[model samples]
Target: MKRILSISLLLLFNLGQSRAQSEKKIAFGPYIQQMGTKDAAVCWSTLVGSMTVTDPSGKTDTIREYKQHAIYFQGLKPDTKYSYDVLNDGSNEGKGTLTTFPDKIVPFNFVVIGDTRTRNNVHKKIIEQVTKRDPRFIVNSGDLVSNGWSMKNWESFFEINHDFMKNTPYYPVLGNHEKDSPYYYNFFDLPNNERYYYFTVGDALFIVLDSEGHRTSIPAYTTEGNEDAYWEQSGIEYLKKEKEWLEQVLKLNHQAGFVFIFQHQTLYSVKKSRVEESKKVRAFWGDIFSRYGVQVFLNGHDHHYHHAYDKGVHFITSAGGGAPLYDIDAPQPETVNYKKIEHFINVEVKLDEAVLHVIDIDGNEFDTIKVKRRDVK
Candidate 1:
């Protein structure tokens, strides 16, 4: 009788362990990534381990770690919608839909939002609005999280965007807050080198640039006077290569009907403090946008809606995703419109033209811009 009782207890202990192991939930995502005309990837993560830390002030916090998983699909038909389940266990948590980019020129729409760093409630609301629009894809101008290194911040970001991101292919620009963290690259599956890349949906060309460049720490021996030069020179080679690549891409894709470029920092600013920095950035890019006939240049970081027109290029600052709004202190000469509000842009790519509807948080169309198709021969 004693031997039998011991056997039963051991069985119970093993069963409890099995149940505990099975209870590990997905940390975040079963999100879509690297969507193309013939291929797509589904990505997700699960908790691996965690550590507890106690601050000097006696405040304790728990930091969790996660492992990412992805599955790629190829030989897919273009302009078709497909249902995917990362987990085949009949759970809805891992189920989502994806649509491939059209093989030929066709009508489609996409949403653009920016600076979704803080203000979770506002971010959630904006995400909800974006989902309602049902864009073919989504572009986040940058600053997706307050701290890219913080797992908690990423958790919140994925949680807020899960429903929409699970279905829509998300493209993110590298913002200053990202800090060139490996987490950003790990979480996102993109095309080309991923830092600064280009994609196409039909005849519309979308180019994303890395304005933040590589985040390098200044050496302790460096003097304050040379700090700026050090920082600039650190990423000069990378930026130069990217600029050359951009010029090549633009030249090669000159037949594209529409071209939209995105970066984290603005080239034209209406804010008093950032105007000079914007000018410097503009100087760097020079006549690239106008020369390439790029229709729109979109960015984040300023936390407001600013539209500036220069040499036929529409420079739009759509950073009001969730961060605190900044006052438009000094409207530039090219400023077509500026608004301090939480908003997103829904762009409709038609046969002959692309129309951008700048909608505010309350679903009001405060601004609209229409650009005719490039004279593609």
Candidate 2:
């Protein structure tokens, strides 16, 4: 009897060990995505395993492998809240809430943040403040991670944003720091061609443009003098195609009550170093924004807050999410206001106009811009 009892205990120990090994732990997300009037998606990742490698210098690196999972829902009610559990195994880790976008014209509010790369503490604080506002959704005008190719960086990003993103849908623009990684595409479920797309909330149109065309390496044989030319020509075709698409989208949505455009690069930079580049960008998309009545053109790249007005379009650089701040040394002719501080914008869309309250990390409102709704025929 004693021997049998000992054997039973050993078997139970092994069973418990197996169960523990088999249990799944969420590594990222279980966050809301692809939010629309009647459909939504919840995505999550789980650590599957890890591998260690030793370099020539005897430096060891351990890479964690993760498996991504998503559940999509359809035929849901518009502008309604719903709770979801991806795991449904009595674990809160897999649980989250989501609200669908409204199907009809109505008032709403959303948040815009940019360059939330590095400075996890600051990012967390910004998120805390943004959460208090209870925005319907959030848009990051690129640079979501310092190095989009680094899984570790992404891990930190998702961890910091877990609580807020679990309910609010996130839309991201592509920044240079993203390095055109496949990881960015893997994590996001965007509209249209993904790179450049447009979405609508009632009569308000939100367009995201991919200013950083396809990232490619220069040819080894290219001479130093021709390097810049090669770089320019590499993505010229893609940019042209994207421009055509943008024009078509703008033309089709000309009657939108509110039109907001977002990109990763600025068209009006107050940073001395980036002024020329900004001019080049502005020249490339000459007068298109004014012609299409884009009320606000929001971008990130320069780590500061600068607003400019030209021909009915408001150009804003709100890249104050964490990354080191840069000085506003070159104020352009159209500059309205400039500040070198970390901040985010809360846009409240009402019947007559949309009010943008530019609030800093300390919860101080520094500037406000109101764009009247476009009059429809």
On lDDT, the candidate that comes out on top is 1
Q: Model 2: runs farther than 4 Å from truth?
A: 1-24
RMSD values for the candidates in order, in angstroms, are 8.5, 8.3
Q: Please, what is the whole-model Cα lDDT of each candidate in the order they appear?
A: 0.89, 0.88
lDDT (tens digit, per residue) of candidate 1 on 1-377 = 00111000001111122456655345688898999998989888877667999999999999987777888888887887887766665567677888888898989999999999999999999998888889999999999999999989999999999999888999999999888888999999999999999999898999999998874899999999999889988988888889999999999999999999999999999989999888888998999999989999999999999999989999999999999999999998899999999999999999999999999887889999999999988
lDDT of 2: 0.88
Model 1: residues with Cα > 4 Å off, grouped in runs: 1-24
Candidate 2 per-residue lDDT, tens place, 1-377, comes to 00111000001111122356556466788788888998988887777777898999999988877777777788888888777766666667677788889988989999999999989999999999999999999999999999988988898999999999998999999999999998898888888888999889987999999999985898899999999788878898999999999999989988889999999999998989989989898998999999888899999999999999999999999999999889889999999999999999999999889999999998999999999999876
Candidate 1 all-Cα RMSD: 8.5
